[model samples]
Target chain A: MRAAGRRAPALLVLVSVLLIAADHWITLTPLRAFGSGVYGSLENVTSSVTRWASDARRLETVERENARLRAEVLTGRRPTAAVAGAAAAYQVVSAHAIGFGGDQTVTLDVGTGSGVARDMTVLNGDGLVGRVVQAGPSTATVLLATAPSSSVGARLETSREVGLVTGVPDRGLLRLSLLNADAAVRVGDRVVTLGSENMRPFVPDVPVGSVVAVEGTSGALTRTALVRPFAHFSTLDLVTVVVGPGRPGDGAPQ
Target chain B: MRDPARKPAGNPAGRALLAVALVLLAPVAQVSVVNGLGLPGGGPDLVLIGVVTLGMVLRPMAATVVGFAAGLAADIAPPADHSIGRHALVLCLIGYLCALVPADSSAGQRTAAALGGTLGGALLDAALAGVLGDESWTSVLGGLPGSLAWTVAGGTLVAVALVSLLPRRRRFGGPASRAAARGHYTGGHHA
Candidate 1:
């Protein structure tokens, strides 16, 4: 028994090393999916608990926002046509924000069973949240726009100047680049998604963020600006997944 | 304090069950509550702390098994950025090394050792990530100290708790007391 005890750790370590190598050589999709399912369920439970704990504060915030929005509507400042287009064009699947993976990824309670698919866009009431990278049967993973590898086509709402918005993971900020130097880009300019073909990954005109800083001189061939995303990546709670071109049963908009 | 050389006494099955429970719950807490606590760099690695604490009390082999399972659970847990097993490999070594510490060591000493182990594991993880080209050397190195600090703080707390709660018989005194009692009886008979 003593001898066996001495050998146990070595054997287990060896097994762990081999498992690591195996994971790299092959896609452990089934295993990974299973793990995700378990974690996702646990996350769902925990998120609910946290949500319940903060219910009163959240309720007060919501009420204040609702009153502000009502005043905006009464003042004849209705939402733009682009906002309306987004609302009508995509089927929104409501989901609870479960947990974040590292700094750039988040897991959601909804998944393939709820019409979530890879590359589907995720959003909240404020703005864009992320895009789905993996969707399991009952859970999905979203790669936030703030990840180092994430990039989205964006246009300045004022000048309509198009550029690419890429994430700076270390700084927790997004940078917009490749805009024409002559473009009327300035501080506080609203940025919106340029959209993709058939709206698969990103739908057009959804609010992305605002320019916080403009980089380079005025006459350069191209310019870049730092953007602060509208959605609070750290405090995400409820979000909507844009499943497709139309509402679930509407069978794709013409 | 109990004798360090004594074989530990406890229900192996109960201990195994407890290990499983810790492995499952540690990562969930790490992801949900701990990570959300908004500590700088990230939350302390609760799973790593648990492994180290267990290592200090359990036999080397048992501790190692617990470490591997806990590490694997952490790897597969959501928000894991690197390839699976990086954490497992690090924790396994840390557990084995920690188990080698004398069981009779003071709880404070054990906790300090666990903190050191947590720091070492965090650094090893960062180094591995750098070698794998998953992250830049600068980024990995930059984040190492802060991560280490957090893990150490967390590990210290966990070690303290484990030391306080584990049965003294299971941890240090059982087998040695029995052996000593037997020796005393034989000597008296001979006298």
Candidate 2:
């Protein structure tokens, strides 16, 4: 209430400003890593208690084996053919989604320890989940495709016309801007990632979503459409992080 | 002017421990459990609410320090990509304002200030993000109405509980202010 009282708050505020200025210039990777190391472990512990035993690494493997056997006994060949076929193209590391962020991001249990790094593709059974933006020692942060900062190069699944997909966070959808002014875009057209050179952030042919609605009219400038993603962002549990292309001896099945 | 009754056993040490625990647990709980619950109206910022609640008890200096620490935790927690110290600035100012409202205030006044602090803290956060050119600021603004309603609602519960439970630091207040508190606050917070 006096001089000393007000001085402390002012001093703290100054320190915060300094920290923000410092952050603008540098990556602040070490601080983020420290945060991840401390709170990520805490999240891991509490998440284990909250979820079932199958949430554990060992039990999860056993459950996956059981599911594979159950599917083989029931249907004959691999039921998850689409996902298997997509995953076979890459050497992937499985990760559990352990945390969710307000910024439309999620924390995966895998990190640099599992060869997961920044700008790597992440996908689940349904479709594209996100891309790894930051990786700590034991955990990695993935910026969801639904984030406003996200923009992915995509192409129509059938016509193969290329476009760019950016997140419209307000609608929980993606906005695809086709390069062609007269691009033939319609509702229900499938969209997929164009894939980067060597597939750093995204791999080609990964189903992004189906066009829900086309923006603007016939022809003016670049045509745009709204896309509804296939993955249910609300209940994500398991996903795979694409580490690199499949090496020798891991070619496609005959 | 620490209240003898509230300062059990180790006095300032116990208070510091609780502050540290809150700074640590709130952010971890937010990312790991609260955010994933899929709560309606975007739920509340638990760390912000914690800062507001604790601010009502600690002195201005202590509250400011704790608020800064709590905000830093929230900013750096995994999956958070915002610039560090963005939250620290907002919550530090908020804590100071909350503590400026003397502990001898009426229950209604305390509730009003706590809710106001939460609302203001959230707004300041969005404003800073926009100013800082964080891309999500637009979408965050789109969702602000719902978030504001939920955060105020959440603030009401924590503020009331802590106000009614903790002993007020009334050592520096006049008898008339004590009388006003006695009349307005029937919960007998003067332990």
Clashing pairs in 1: A101-B79, A102-B79
Pick out the ten consecutive residues of candidate 2 chain B with the lowest summed lDDT: B1-10
For model 1, residues A1-254, the per-residue Cα lDDT tens digits are 34555577778778777877887898666766776788767877888888899999999999998998788878968665455457666777789778776546787888777888889888887788888887877778888898776889999987888899988756667999856877777899999999988887888889988889988677887888899998888888788888877554675322
C-alpha lDDT of residue B28 in model 2: 86
Each candidate's fnat, listed in order, reads: 0.49, 0.79
Q: Which stretches of candidate 2 lie over 4 Å from their true place?
A: A53-82, A248-254, B1-14, B166-191
Error of 2 at B109 (Å): 1.4
* Candidates, DockQ: 0.37, 0.49
The 0-to-1 C-alpha lDDT of every candidate, in the order given, reads: 0.76, 0.82
lDDT of 2: 0.82
lDDT for position A128 in model 2: 89
Off by over 4 Å in 1: A1-7, A53-75, A79-84, A179-184, A218-222, A247-254, B1-14, B106-109, B136-138, B162-191
lDDT of 2 by residue, B61-133 (tens): 7889999999999888887888899999999999888877766666788889888999999889988988877
